[model samples]
Structure formats: C-alpha cells, structure tokens
Target chain A: MKELIQLIASFVGAIGFSLIFGLHGKQILLAGIGGACTWGVCLLTDFLGCSLPLAIFFAAVFGSFYSECLAKILRVPKTVFLFSVLISLIPGSNLYLAMRYAIEVNRELAMANAIETLTVALAISLGIIVMLVTSQIQARIKSRGNRN
Target chain B: MSLTSVREKDRMADAAGVVRLALDVGEQILLSGGEVGRVEDTVLRICTSYGAVRTDVFAITSLVFVTAVWENGEIVTQSRRIKEVGKCMRRLEELNSLSRRICTERPTLAEAEKAFSEIMKRSESSWVKVLIGSLLAATAYTAFFGGDLKDCLVAPFVAAVIFGSQFLTKKIGGNKFFSQALCSFLATAAASFAVAMHLGSSVDHIMIGCIMILIPGISVTHAVENLIIGDTIAGLISLSEALVIALALAGGFALSQSLFGGLLI
Candidate 1:
C-alpha cells in the first residue's frame, strides 16, 4: 500500500513538473505515467535485493527507453519526456543530507553521503548513455542498409 | 558595373538571410534548454536544406556560431549569444517540429519567421499555472518523501512562500544564484515555522520535498548528455552551473536552519 501511494505521488510530482515546464495536454499525462512506471521499476528492483544505485540504474534505463520510443512516436525531442520521467530518481534528498552534514562539521558522514550521491548520479548517466549509444548505432546500421 | 554590383549585393543579402534564419532556430533551441548537440544538428540541417553546399556549426550552452558556403563559394557567417536558459518543453517541441518542417518543406524566409513568432507568442504560460504547479509539486513530493498528510498539507503554503520569493526576485532582475538561495531560504524558514506551529510533523521531509522542485536535475542530465556527445565545453559549463545552484540551495537551507534551529527537527 505504501509503495502504491508513493507511485501515485511520483505520478503527481511528474505531472506538476510537466506543468511547470510548460508541457500541455497529452504530454503531461504521458510524462506522469512514465514517471510512475520508472519508480515502479526502481521499487521492483530494490525488492529483488538489488543495490540502491543498481536499482536506480535499471529505472533510468527503463525511463530512457520509454522516452526514446515516445519521442519517435510523438515526433518530439526525447528530453521533453525524459526530464519529467526521471525526476523521481534524482537523489535530491541525499545531496541535501550531504550538504547538511558538511555544514555541521561531520566530515565522515558528509564524505560518505557525497560519494553515494556521486555514485548514484554516475549510475543514472551511464544508464542513459547505454540506451543513447545503442540507438545511435541502430540508426547508423539502418541508414547504411538503406544506402546499400 | 553598377548593375552587376547591385545584383551581387542582393545575392549576399539573400545568403545572409538564410544564415540568419538558421541561427535563429538554433538560438531558440538553445535558449529553450535543448541539448547542444540538437541545436548544432538542427542548424546544420536547416542551412543545408536551404542550399548551403557546406555548413559548419559550433555551439555551447550560451553561444552558437555557424558559417555556410554557397554553391558559388560565397560564405556567410553568423553567431548568436544566448543570454538565458529556461525550460519550456512545449516550446522545445514546437521548435523541433518547426525545424523538421523547414528541412522538409524549405519554407520561405517570411513564412519561417512567421511560424517562429507564433511559437514564441504562445510559449509564455500564465502565472497562475506556474503557481499551481509549484504547489502541487511541493505537496506531492512531500508525500513521496515520507511526509504524512499533515506535512503534505503544509507543504503548499511553504511552496507559496518560495514562489512569491522567486517572483519578487525575478521582478527585481536578481541574478540566478541569489534568487535560488532566497527561494530556498524562504522555503526552509516556512517549513520550520509550520512544524513548530504543530502544522506538520517532520521538517526534513518538507524541506526535501520543496528542494526537489528547485533541484537542477534537468541541467545535470543535459550536461551528462552533452559530454557523452563530445560537446565537452558545453558539458562542463552546465555541470559547473548545476554545482553552483546546488551550493546556493544548500547555503540557503543551512542559514535558515541555523536561525531556527530549535524549531526544526
């Protein structure tokens, strides 16, 4: 039940951001759905005993895939959807904790949280890079085949 | 000689017009927070579509430079300096579609300019919508971050304070970092006060929730994307910007927490 509410919260959060970003109509709803599904994937991976960073990585992979496919179908840039979809996994709270600890002179705790934040950030970016590279390669092969 | 010179002048003006149009599209994309790669690619495509035999484009977060060579080897170079970057996904979509249409249809300069103006005119959303968006984001993220119903309920009021501060800063033409710090400080102070008044349960969750709305997630993602695409300069510029904004947000929150230490949990 808690997970379900969190998913809903993620959806609402995405929708709010979509509005803030000036997305309208169907795009907002699609972004919301995408955000919910991304969080759901993260939760599922975490439930399966995956590490938190690994779970976020998988979630980002799914989110990027979702946005790429949607962009193709909708004839829009992928970032429009990608931004809102991945909003739920940005590790904002952890970053805040790191800042707070640093200010309080808790050097060890701040260093630990800062490293964790960087790791999670790296994982998310790597996931996005993997999908992007794959898509570029696929496009190249398809274009080459057409020329042949 | 006079007749030939007049004709040459006309040709030069025509080529300059095409280059200007292409640069205009690229600038809009950059200003609307499109990726540097996409902005460069779109400019190149648009110039080539308009009969440039060769085109070279260099784009970073704040500037775009393009030089196009015509069939007769005449060259036109143009550059645009983008002063501000803001996200408007709808405008980005419209600009993307406009670029695609220009490439496929090769519209006349007047027609393309008209279309671009129309997109710009429709890009500004009402202030009410933005306020509502802030409220909703603050409330929903509060819940998502483990805030109970009371905390969630209090988050919107705190969000309103942040929104008002942001609006005031914008009106005063304050710098980005100062405005961000002001908004974060106000948000933290309001959240702490609410918790002290028994209007909410947890200050941490509320502050985190409000911070989610202010985080530079899109900029960070775009920076990474730019780096992967080999636009290293643009990537680094944006990455540094994200870091500064994050630091400012933390600074604001820390100041507020210190002032209201007893009220915050």
Candidate 2:
C-alpha cells in the first residue's frame, strides 16, 4: 500500500516538473511514468536491505534506461524525460542534512552526511553514464552493419 | 556581367548563408542547455550538407565558435556569447526536430531561416498553468516523502504562496543568488509553521519538497555527460555552476534552521 502511494506521488512530482520545464503534449505523462518507475525500483531495493547508494544507483540505471527507450519510441530527446524522472532519486534530503550539521559545527556528523551525499551522487551519475555508453556502442555496431 | 559568372556568385553566397544558419541553430541549442557535443554534431551536419568545404565548431558553457570554409575560398565564422543558460525542454525538442528536418528536407536558405524563426517562437505555457503545476508537484512531494494527509493538503497552499512571490522576484530581475536564498528560507519557515499548527508529523519532508526547485540535478547530469563525451571545458563550467547554486541553497537552509530551530525538530 505504501509503495503504491509513493508511485502515484512520484508520478505527480514528475508531471509537475515536466510541466514546469515546458515539456509539451504526451511527453509529460510519459515522464511521469518514468519517475514512478524509478521510485518503485528504489523502494524495492531499500526493502531488500541494500545500502542507500547502491539502491539509488540501481534505481537511476533503471530510470535512465526506461527514459532512453521511451525517447526512441516517441521520437524525442531522451533528456527531456530523464530530467524530470531523475528528480525523485536525487539526494535532496541528504544534502540538506549535511549542510545543517556543518552549520551547527558538528564536524563528525557533517562529514558522514557529506560522504553519503557524495557517494549517492556519484552512483547516480555513473549509472546514467554506463547506460549511455552501452547505447552508443549498440548504435555504432548497427550503423557499421548497415554500411557493410 | 556574364549570366554564368552571376550564377556562380549566387552559389558562393548560398554556401555562406548556410554556414550562418548552422551557427544560429547551434547557438540556440547550446543556450537552451543542450550538451556540448550535441550542439557540435548538429552544426557540423547542417553546414556540411550545405556544401561547406571545411567546418569547425567549438562550444563552452557560455560561448559558441563556428567557422566554415567554402569550396570557393569564402570563409564564414560566427562567435556568439550566450547571455543566459536556461532549461527549456520544449525548446530543445523543437530545435532537435528542426535540425533533423533540415538534414532530411534539404530546405533552401530562405526556407530554413523562416522555419527556424517559427520554431524559436513556440508558445509558452500560461502563468496559470505553471503555478498549478508547481503547486501540485509540491503537494505530491509532500506525500511521496512520507508526509501525512494534513501536510498534503497544506503543501499546495504553501507552494502557491512561494511561487507567487517567485513571480514577483522574476519580474524584478533581482540577483539569482540572493533570491534563491530568500526563497529557501521562506519555504522552510513555512514548513515549520505547518508543524506549529499541528499539520503534520514531519517538518523536514516539507523542506525537501520546497528545495526541489533549487536542486542542481540538470547541471550536474549535463556536466557528467559532457565529460563522458570528452568535452572537458564545458563539463567543468557546468560543474562549477552546479556547485555555486548548491552552496547558496545550503547556506539558506542552514540559516533558516537556526532561526526556527526551537520551534520544530
């Protein structure tokens, strides 16, 4: 039940950003689905007792892959959908906590939160980069075959 | 003048026109927050098809340099210094489609220019729609982040107030740094107010929703993308911008927490 609500909320959040970012027509709805899918993956991984960064990494990978395929199928730039959906996975709260702890002069707690933020950020970005490289390689192989 | 000579002159002029057109499209894409390599590729494709003998494109975060040499030895170059960087997915999509069509349709210089102008002027969403969308998104985040029913209900009200103020700040053209700090402080304070009113169990969730507007996800993602594509300069610029914005956001939240610390959390 909790997972279901989170999915809807993720969809709403994604649609909200998609609209603000000036995504037009049916692309808004598609981006919303991408956002919800990312949340669902994140939730499942968390449920399985995976660490925060690892779960976020897998979730980001899934979201980017989903967005890439949808963009191809819909004939639009993949970033249009990926940008909106990726919001759900961003470590906004963790960033806030790290900064707050630092302001209070609690160096130890601040460092821990800061490290977590860095790890999650790297995991998310690297996950997307991996998907991008794989897709480019696949495209190159197909184009070469056509040339031959 | 001989008719044949005049015709040859027209062909050279046509080549120059196409090179200029390619630069315009590339500048538009770059300023609209596209990755560096994508801008380079689009310009290269357009200029080559228009019969440029040689082409070079160099792009950074705020500037684009494009030069082309025609078969007749006419060299055309453009340097555009972009004034602002904005994220407009609709415009990006439109420009992408325009470049793709230019490749396939092979439009003449005049026709291509006309099409480009029209695409750039694609209509903006009304303010009413933007406000509603933002408000709804805020409410959804409140719920998604584990806020209960009362927080969900109050989230839109706070969002409306925040965006309402944002509209004024945008029109006034204030400095982005101070304005962002102001907005974060205001949003978090409102979340604290909600806790005082017994609206929800969580104050931090509301702040997280409010801070969504300040998150640097786009810049960070684009920076990594540029780096992966071997455009180190553009990537570094984007990373710096992201870092600066993040610093401002954190500063605002920390200050606000000190003021409202005793009230909640």
Candidate 3:
C-alpha cells in the first residue's frame, strides 16, 4: 500500500514537471508513468537491503532504458522522457539537508551529507552511462552487420 | 578557374544556404537543452542530405560551429553564440522530426527554412499554463518527500509566489546568481511561515520539497552524459554550470536558513 501511494506521488511529481517542461500530447502521461517506474525500482531495491547508491544505480538504469525505448516509440527526443523519469531519482532531500547542516555549523554532518549526495549523483550518472554505452554498442554491431 | 564562372559562384551560395539551415536546426536544439551528440548529429545529417560534400558541426553550451563544403570546393561556415538557454521539449521534438525528414526526403533550402521558421514561431507557452504547472510541480514534490496533506496544500501557494518573483526578475534582468538565491529565500520564507503557523510537522521535510523545485535536474543530466560521451569540453562547461546553479540553490536556502524555522533538522 505504501509503495502504491509512493508510486502515485512520483507520478504526480512527473506530471507537474511535464507541465513546467512544456511536454506536449501523450508525453505528459508517459512522463508521469516513467517517474512511477523509477520510484518503484528505487524503493524495491532499497527495501531489499541494497545500499542507497546501488538502489539509485538500478533505478537509474531502468529509467534511462525506459527513456530510450519511449523516445524511439514516441519519435521524440529522449530528453522528454529523461526529465520526468529521473525527477524522482534526484537526491533533492539529501542535498537540502546537506545545505542545512552546512549552515548550522555542523561541519561533520554537513561533510558526510555532502559526500552522500555526491554518491547519489554519481550513481545516477553511472546508470545513465551504462544504458548509453549498451545502446551505442548495439547500434555499432547492427551497423557493422549491415555492412557485412 | 579563379573568378570567371558565375554558375560556380551561385553553387557556392547554395552551399551557404544549406550551412545556414543546418546551423538553425543545431542552434534550436542546443538552445532547447539537447545533448551535444544530438545537436551535432542533426546538423551533420541535414547538411549531408542537402548535398554538402562535407560537413562538420561542433556545439557546446554557449556556442555552435557548423561548416559545410560544396562540390565546387566552396566552403561555408557559420557560428551561433547562444546568449540564453531555456527548456521547451516541444521545440526539441519538432527539431528531431524535421531533421528526420530533411535526412530522408531532402527538402530544398527554401522549404526547410520555411519549416524551421514555422517551428520557431509556435506560440509561447501561456503564463497560466506555466503557473499551474509550477504549482503542480511543487505540490507533487512535497508529496514525493512524504509530506502530509497540509504541506501539499501550502506548497502551491508558495510556488505561486516563487513564480511571480521569477517573472519580476525576468523584467529587471539582474544578475542570475543573485536571482537564484532570491528565489530560494522566498521559498524558504514561505515554508517557514507555514511551520510557524503550526501547519506542518518538519521544516526540513517541507523545505526539502519546496527547494526541490529549484534543483538543476536537467543540467546535471546533460552534464553527466556529456562527460561520459567523450565531450569533455562541453560536458565540463555544463557540469560547472550545473554545479554553480546547485551551489546558488543551496546558498539561497543557507542565506535564509537562520531567519526561518531555526534549522529544524
């Protein structure tokens, strides 16, 4: 039940961003679903006792692959899906607390939070890079086969 | 062979036209927050399909370089220095679609230019749409972080004030860093006000949701992709841009953290 509500919340967040990003046509709903999927994978991994970074990595991989597939299907740029799909993955709260800890003079907690934030950022990037590399390699092999 | 053939000169002018059209497409893609690879590919594809013997397209965050060579050994080059960047997925979609057609169907220069202009002339997003969208975004962000109904209810109001100030700042056109901080100050202030009224439970949670609206999600995404795709130069530029924006966003909340809610951790 909790997971379901979180999924809906993630969906709503993406819909809101779809509006702000000026996404058009059927993309609005697709973007919302993309967010829900990211959140779901993230929550599931985190619940399975994986580290936070690992959870983010898995979620990001799913989200980026989803974006590529949706882009191909929708015939729009991948960014349309990229934005809404990854919104829920961003470590917004972690960054906020890091800033707060910095301001409050708790240098230790601030540094720890800051480093953790970096981990999340890196995990998300790693996920994107993984998907990007896989897709590029697939394209290369296909192109080579066409030549043969 | 030097300067006697008027027909040769006319062919050179046609090459220039193709280069210009290619640059226009690239400029729109870059301006609309496209990846470096996408921008480069679209420009090259359009130039090649339009009969350019050779083409080179290089784009970064703030500038675009497009060069095309004609069969007559005439070279045409154009550079567009982008002064601003904004997000409009619709424009990006249109550019992608148009580039596909240009590559496959080979539209004439005039036809392609006409189509590109029409894409640019699409109506600006109405303010009402933006405002409502922003409102929804902030409220939904609040819920994403596990905020209760009261927090969600208050966020849209806060988002309205933030958007209003953002609009005002546009008219004045002051320093970007200062404006970013100013926006953060306003958002934090509103969240603090709600906390003071006993309408919300945790200031950190609520403020986290509110400030989530300002984080540079798209910029960071592009920055990461650029860095990995061997576009070290463009990637680093946008990465720094994203870092600075993130710092400014944090600075915004830090500047007002004391004045609001007393560091409710």
lDDT per residue (tens digit) for residues B1-265 in model 3: 6643554455356887888888888998888767878889988988887667888888888888988887778788899998768777888888889999988877667788899999888835566767877887778888777888888888888888789878888889988777888888888887788778878666666777767678876677668778887999998988888788778877877767776657542
Question: What class would a CAPRI assessor give candidate 1's docking?
Answer: medium
Q: What is the TM-score of chain A alone in each candidate?
A: 0.96, 0.92, 0.95
| lDDT of each residue in B1-265, candidate 1, tens digit only | 6975665445455888888988998998888778888999999998888778899999998899999999878899999988878888888899999999998987777798899989989886667877888898889898997889999999999889988998899899968998999989888899989898889998888888888888886688778777877889999999999999998998898899899856455
- Candidate 1 per-residue lDDT over residues A1-148, each given as its tens digit: 8898899999999898888887888989999999999999999999999999999999999999999999999989988898888888888778878978987999999989888877888778878888899999999999999999
Clashing pairs in 1: none
Please tell me which predicted candidate would have the highest TM-score against the true structure: 1
- DockQ class, candidate 3: medium
TM-score of each: 0.95, 0.91, 0.93
RMSD of each: 3.0, 2.7, 3.3
lDDT of 2 by residue, A15-109 (tens): 99888877878888888988998989998999999988889889989989998998899787887788788888876667777777788899999
What interface root-mean-square deviation (Å) does model 1 yield?
1.2
DockQ of each: 0.73, 0.64, 0.72
Higher-TM-score candidate among 1 and 2? 1
**Candidate 1 chain B worst ten-residue window by lDDT:** B4-13
Ranking of all predicted structures according to lDDT, beginning with the best and ending with the worst: 1, 3, 2
Fnat of model 3, as a fraction: 0.72
